[model samples]
Target chain A: MKNTLWKALGILILVYVFAMTMLVPLGPGLLEFQDVNQVIESTREGRAVPEFQVIGFGTHWDQLPDSLQVFVQSKGQLAALEVIRVDDATHATVGLTLPYSLPAKSWNVLTNHPVDGTLLLENGLFLSDRFIDAKATWPAPSFIEHSSQLGLHFPYQPRIVETIRNLMLHVPLWFTMFLLMGIGFVASIKQLSNPRNQRDDDRAVASVQVGIWFGVLGLLTGSLWARFTWGAWWVDDPQLNGALVTVLVYSGYMVLRQAVDDERLRARLAAAYNLFAFVILVILLMVLPRFSESLHPGKGGNPGFNSYDLDSALRAVFYPAVIGWMLLGTWMYLVTLRMKRVNRQIELLP
Target chain B: MQGLAFLLGLESTAIAFAALLSVLSAISSRAGAGFGLTAVLGLPLIIPIVLISTRYGTDILNGILWIDTAHHLLFLGALTGGIGTLGFILFPYLWRD
Candidate 1:
């Protein structure tokens, strides 16, 4: 009954992890930026900034407020105008720009370029003017107000937007892998201290099995992310190659364990190799490559950590992702240990 | 059997719903599947729906379509729900002798 309960809990936890990963809105959706022609016609009677209306999925023609006037009347040719509306509850904002050109009885309909027509409520949702806490008015020139000599504007890459969510999955896999391997290292060290204790040997073996799984998951998620972000499944990056080498060394530990038949001798030698492999793994994965230029984080030439990456929404989902996956990994280890015990019980029955 | 197709379809739908509920559970508990299953199921459902809506959704939104968007959502929901429930029901039996 207790075993079944644990198994049930494990399944529930596994399902939960998969669930959060999907439903969490942590990445960019269909983004559209179009040059809207808002024309203000003046025939010497008076100058009026012409009001323009755009009709689309969320905010159709009917949703337009009768109280709110269409155009911001300006004296001079408006170089850049931005309207920011912040939602009081979620604190998310939508900024729309007023582009050049508007004439009498002229209306435009601009749909999001890559419209996500998901049945999900978030897909076609639009920011209503009512829910806004405050609106910040800024000129286009204000964007470059900070710097004049150097202005860096990253190209709008779709892959970068999609791959941003991968930070939760791939990075956590490595973190969990490191953590598992660290446990293995400690267990191996303990076994080295007391060569007589079989429990230490079993623990060390279990850690390696769990650690290897995490490493494999890391590689798979990383490769998938690489395929999307870098346009290739395998890239010749320093960090990528180093991680592969680290995983391979750990794999060798498994092979070495199987080669030896004597249990005592196998445990002693495998534990020693595990300790060695772990040190090398840390150096390869976390230390050496970080100093050099690499595409992967923690080992890259990029100095900034949170700049343009690790947005608030992504962070909210990411921390939990790490915790959930790590817990799941630990759960798998427990199950494997139980299965091993069951095998021994059946073995003794004969 | 008619029941089998309905059962499979229902299981798929249940798995889909379970995927959603599981996500909410993860959020509250800070542990579990996280968001993998929803994403997998979402891809097939969301992509087609989003594509159909964004490009052709204007007509649907304007109420010109023969079938409402709700119906489509229902079909998808039912299909996923059915399948997910079927899977849950079969889990115990799967390991049984």
Candidate 2:
């Protein structure tokens, strides 16, 4: 058991990661403002804006109501929201009494609490375009010191508030797949050069079989993440298509193995196919996805992991998760290789 | 115009498709692999070429010039080259046994 120290380390790291992934609370973020029914008539003339129920995640508005400063800021214009009442830490009511002279309707919400620091939401409120061109000089910016909250909390993103936790779960699977397939590719190349030693073929097949398992997991987890974030189980994105195609190509390798009758011939043929398939896999997954327009994060024009999306707190856990998954995949591949070798031995006994 | 684009696509498709078919048939006939196994192996490889060429054809029909379709054209060419080269190197090994 002590000989398999890395396997035990992988188990330990995975257990630690599972705990960290769920335990780390996300930072304060603005939820939607309750919609108001009172529509303003063309002008702010004699009309009063309704009190908006402000909702936030992990914000302490109730306890720090006195120090709570809410403002709708855009360009050079600014209008601080009047906190009429504090319902709870996550709920509050703020008067939307705009500065009658303020001309901007497209603005952002900024709230500063002594404890939680400043939470900002982009494109928070839009009064209407009617007042956008209104001839009025707005209030100057009230430059206040925005302090950072002291604690380990994941950075809150707009649409991916809580589901950002999926980064730890979904991305590591693919990275592990890439690593395993790469190992398989090297083994296949070695087998092709030295067909006399058939052990390399077993090693290649074991690595790929385990690799394919991880790839499938990556796809399913990616689909679920897409459903939560992109509002669909599947989309015709280039990265997605590339990944699906890569998996299918490898699956074809399995069928290729079944088609061949002789054991020696099977090993040689399978090695050749694996060599071709791995090159195609790299091109499809890595090269092609980068060139094409894709809906996946960090792709063409899609709002994905912005500058602050992959935060330091996420990296602390995310990097460990990736290494852990890779170790586990390697462990699985070794076990598969051992099992295949044992089966071959049993067949030879007869 | 679409017909011309499609005809060009059909020709290119035939070349790449033929390459795939030849590779699969050579290996299968050598081993007496069934039709299902041959197809199961071939489609995954051929589909990407078909996918790329279909896009190229669509672009041409949408009034994109032959010169403007350089990226797709070069890509299709590159895929064909990669396929041909892989088969050239690998087939010799299969021919031995």
DockQ list for all candidates: 0.01, 0.56
lDDT digits (tens) for residues A1-350 of candidate 1: 97566556645654664565565543212233223345444332234333323222222112222211112222222222222221221121222333323211122211221221111111122222322322323352321211111122111223365455566678878888887788788888787677775677777778789888888889999999888877899987657766777777677667666655666766665675576467557655665455445777555565333646554455556666677667767767766667766776797795
Off by over 4 Å in 2: A39-47, A76-78, A99-105, A133-139, A148-150, A301-307, B1-14, B64-78
Worst 10 residues of 1 chain A by lDDT: A113-122
Instruction: Please tell me how candidate 1 rates in CAPRI terms.
Output: incorrect
Question: Candidate 1, which segments miss by more than 4 Å at Cα?
Answer: A1-14, A26-158, A303-308, A341-350, B1-97
Candidate 2 local lDDT, A100-160, one digit each (tens): 4556767788887887788887887877634455566655547585665558988887778
**Number of backbone collisions per candidate:** 45, 0
| Candidate 2 lDDT score at position B10 | 66
Q: How much is A299 displaced in model 2, in angstroms?
A: 2.3
For residues B1-97, what per-residue lDDT tens digits would candidate 2 score against the true structure?
5566557666767777777677777667656776777788888877777778888888887887766664566667666767677778888777665
